[model samples]
Target: MEQVPLRKIIHIDMDAFYASVEQLDNPELKGKPVAVGGNEVRGVISAASYEARKFGVRSAMSGAQAARLCADLIFVKPNFDRYKEVSKQIRKIFHEYTDLVEPLSLDEAYLDVTENKKGNPSATLIAKEIRQKIFETTGLTASAGISVNKFVAKIASDFNKPNGQKTVNPDEVEAFIEVLDVKKFYGIGKVTAEKMYQLGIYTGTDLKSKSIEYLEEHFGNSGKAYYNLSRGISFSQVKPNREMKSIGAERTFFKNLSSEIYMEERLNNIAEEIERRIKKYKIAGKTVTLKIKYSDFTLQTRSKTLPYFISDKGLIFETAKELLYQEKLKDSVRLLGISLNNLNTHQKKFVVYQLKFEF
Candidate 1:
């Protein structure tokens, strides 16, 4: 059997994207603890600057709690339009090197530059050049990781953060993964890490000792993934033109309420936001899902699939309202959200190209 050559993958992640953009547009915000999204009264922090992070402020944290963590933290509204404009500029730089680019979000992406347009053989040099071009074009910093596959590349990207890059050579892949902490593995979350710890699997070496049957018995299907990933084996490809599965918006109120009237008003605002997002993407969905969270931390979702696709705010709110009253209130609600899926966007076929380069 002919041996397959190694691939050259790079993962690029912007540093504090939202907060950095805010600082770039307003110099006065530079060097200060800044947070984008929400107010002290309600909502959640979308992103926090490096300065804010030192005070334990983090994304998805409640605004009131973040304020308590950092006394002088400044809050700024998220400007998605501005962030999208910058993202476009950065993506143009990536396309200049390779067409195989997979955007994970507005702030990060994976690029397969094994056979790049530049004819560059060194993935490290390409990563360096790409980061430099991104900073030069958008006046923002980016970190990169270059390796033989996406999983290692994603982990290496965080080794040197805030405008830095790391490379894991093909020969070094196994050893690098062996010493890595299980918690730092890309797909393993806190809960899974705890389970691994209970089984005496604290690092890649420990995890590799377990048999596939043993892992599967404990973690179900994910055990197979952990077994392979621990040995530096990953078959995931970097797919370009990734489809958007869904678009949604939600809000956490400062106070919980049992009044259905107030919930209806909140649902209207969320629907308007969803409509704006769908229109911006030029897509409509046949499914509408309403998410409710109670004060006791219990969560529930109600969904309805329409016969026809719709993007109008009026239709979205009406559909969510119908789902809301479809069942009785279990407890006082603290958060409400609306999401649209089963989009009209065309799904692209995934094709895997054989690797032709080796380090």
Candidate 2:
């Protein structure tokens, strides 16, 4: 028996997730400009409602610019607990159709429905059902894109955001590629987009025209990636069941530091990075380990086990600092890493305790 190609990918993204949740809970916020993030002078916007977007407000924009864009813009800090609850709700909805779900962020995920729970094989129908369920359950709208591969599905979802969807059928992949802007392709960041524009590669057609050799000569290995994507030959699959692995971060310095104060400062940064990863996974761990690699290539590790799991940045930093202080390393350090282990799968219970203690 010939195996059927297993490629039914769909990308589902919430529309202004944080801002929409605020509006859903507060009726007065509807139709008004809302920005969800820190409002401090140095803070940047994390999510902007459609009303704010019309006035040039965007995620990562300075608070001052966002405020100037919409004098009526209201700022609301992100509530991680509530957001995590919503993410679980959406994930449960995804599980209704397929177990093959890969979450990219709290607001985005890719699902493979080649063989689905609902018994419907068409990716388009599965996306529709998922979007409808989200609106019915959370009072929020979602935009989805159905395509033959992860790359196309991801790009399709962004084409019509805010309660809309666009599908890219396998047969129409070529036309889709030809019409797409080079900047819109996946993996083409702002820096790469600018570089592509300078090289007269403004569209997918322009990118496709460049031979593999030409791209490799200029952009290295990534050049081959761009060449294939431009021809609508994206082969990336919808990866599933990606577990939350041990969270850690290591950084190398330009200069080896012998001073204790500077080493701790560097450790603080590494600790914060680990905390960010734990927060992203919505999980906490019970062990804190600090890794120090000396300038002479010698490595040292110090670990401490905590009574309770933690996801807070300050706690991780404190534990890592304690480990570093207790270690009797006399050599100068070149690199440092902070890591967490032993996840307490019961995330909500720990989260509540964390709020009471850490907050």
Most accurate candidate by TM-score = 1
How does candidate 1 score on lDDT? Answer: 0.92
Show pairs that collide, candidate 1: none
lDDT of 1 by residue, 1-359 (tens): 22333689999999999999999999999999999997787677999999999999999887888999999999999999999999999999999999999999999999999889999999999999999999899999999999988999999999999999999998899899999999999999999999889889999999998999999999999988898899888878788978888989998888997998999999999998998888889999999999998987688999999999999999999999999999999999989999998899897765445565564
> Which one wins on lDDT?
1
| Residue-level lDDT for 53 in candidate 1 | 99
**Pairs of residues clashing in candidate 2:** none
* Clash statistics: count for each candidate: 0, 0
Q: What lDDT does each candidate get?
A: 0.92, 0.82
Give each prediction's root-mean-square deviation over alpha carbons. Answer: 2.6, 11.6
> Candidate 2 deviates by what RMSD?
11.6
Query: In angstroms, how far off is 110's CA in candidate 1?
Result: 0.6
Query: Against the hidden reference, what TM-scores do the models get?
Result: 0.90, 0.72
Q: Flag regions of model 2 displaced more than 4 Å.
A: 1-6, 243-359
Residue 242 in model 1: lDDT: 80
